[model samples]
Target: MTRSGRLSRDAITAFALLGLIALFAAMLNNRPQTTLSGGFNVIDGDSLSRSGDRFRLVGIDAPEYRQQCERDGVHWLCGQEARALLVKLLQGGSIECRGNDRDRYDRLLVTCRTNEDDINAEMVRRGMAVSFGSYRSEENAARAARAGMWAGNFERPQDFRREEQAGSPKGQDLFAAAADFVKRLAGWN
Candidate 1:
């Protein structure tokens, strides 16, 4: 292949790697989607221990692996539960993914799903994550409607981590937050 051809091939490879990163990042970004999508099983959260390159959930952000509870006042992590749920949902089914771009941490900004279910939305509705699309209006709407991590008294999942990094309370409430999300969506109490 000519030098130009080789350069093109390398660029394609780099792009592919970046896309992969966005997929992983979406799951961690706290911007889970509520629409059906799909892709390959990429990475299994350390908690799940599953084998596959999961088409990372997009549009929402779940708690980190080193978060803490506010009531008991100790160190803890809730991301594992969220990861387990994702693994269970995959069911080895096909996952559709919406690839954006890779973040600094090398995760995909993609929307993932299987059949007709949106894992991202499920995560938020289930109160396992929040809307990390703080600056993005479209994503913000999804987050607001889902009453994601930002719905209740608890802070956004991303912010929670920031607090931990700054030596503050790592608060979370999936149950109450889910209920609040339902309510925020103008759901009948």
Candidate 2:
């Protein structure tokens, strides 16, 4: 204790040292056990292909390539905007991804970062994406701020797909476009 009855210098220093140690330990514990590091090309807002491997940014869902959303009574190309924003983020540096599972669509599910910034979290924070699997805090913040899709009415990507399938002629909706996208990506067509 001192004049103000607070901790003494030595005691405060000891506590600070302990806090530092704990913070270091926590950082070590949270480090990704496995990571994929390399140059990547942005496939869409939440997807990238690195070294021929397609990875989907886990815990976030962005609009589809052709999906539209209504904002202020006008339709906007939210998907294109999301893709452009992701491209901007990627321009900052290379990305590193870490995760093991693959989605049913044959895309690796991973959390990616450019340097120390989490791309998935940034997308949700900016309203370019909605929390899908886990990342609710970032999405909540964006929603509270009325960012991205939160600014207007928009269908969830999955819901949009379902509706497209149900409403399209002969149940073939957007498949041709998606296939063309893949072909163009792979230089196959």
For every candidate in turn, the CA RMSD to the true structure comes to: 16.5, 12.4
Candidate lDDT values, in order: 0.55, 0.86
Give candidate 1's TM-score.
0.46
Question: Candidate 2: where is the Cα deviation over 4 Å?
Answer: 1-34, 169-171, 177-189
Query: After superposition, which runs of candidate 1 have C-alpha atoms over 4 Å from their true positions?
Result: 1-56, 70-77, 134-153, 167-189
Over the stretch 1-189, how does candidate 1's per-residue lDDT look in tens digits?
999999999999999999999988877777544333433342432112113322344566666654533323433345565566666776757765565554564555565557787666666666556555532554456456644333334455667656655553234355555677788799576
TM-score to true structure, per model: 0.46, 0.72
Q: Which one wins on TM-score?
A: 2
Cα lDDT tens digits, model 2, 23-138, are 99988767455588867788878888877888898999999888899999999999999999888877678778888677898888889888899988999899999999878999
For model 2, give the 10-residue run with minimal summed lDDT: 1-10
Clashing pairs in 2: none
Full-model lDDT, candidate 1: 0.55
As a TM-score, model 2 comes out at 0.72
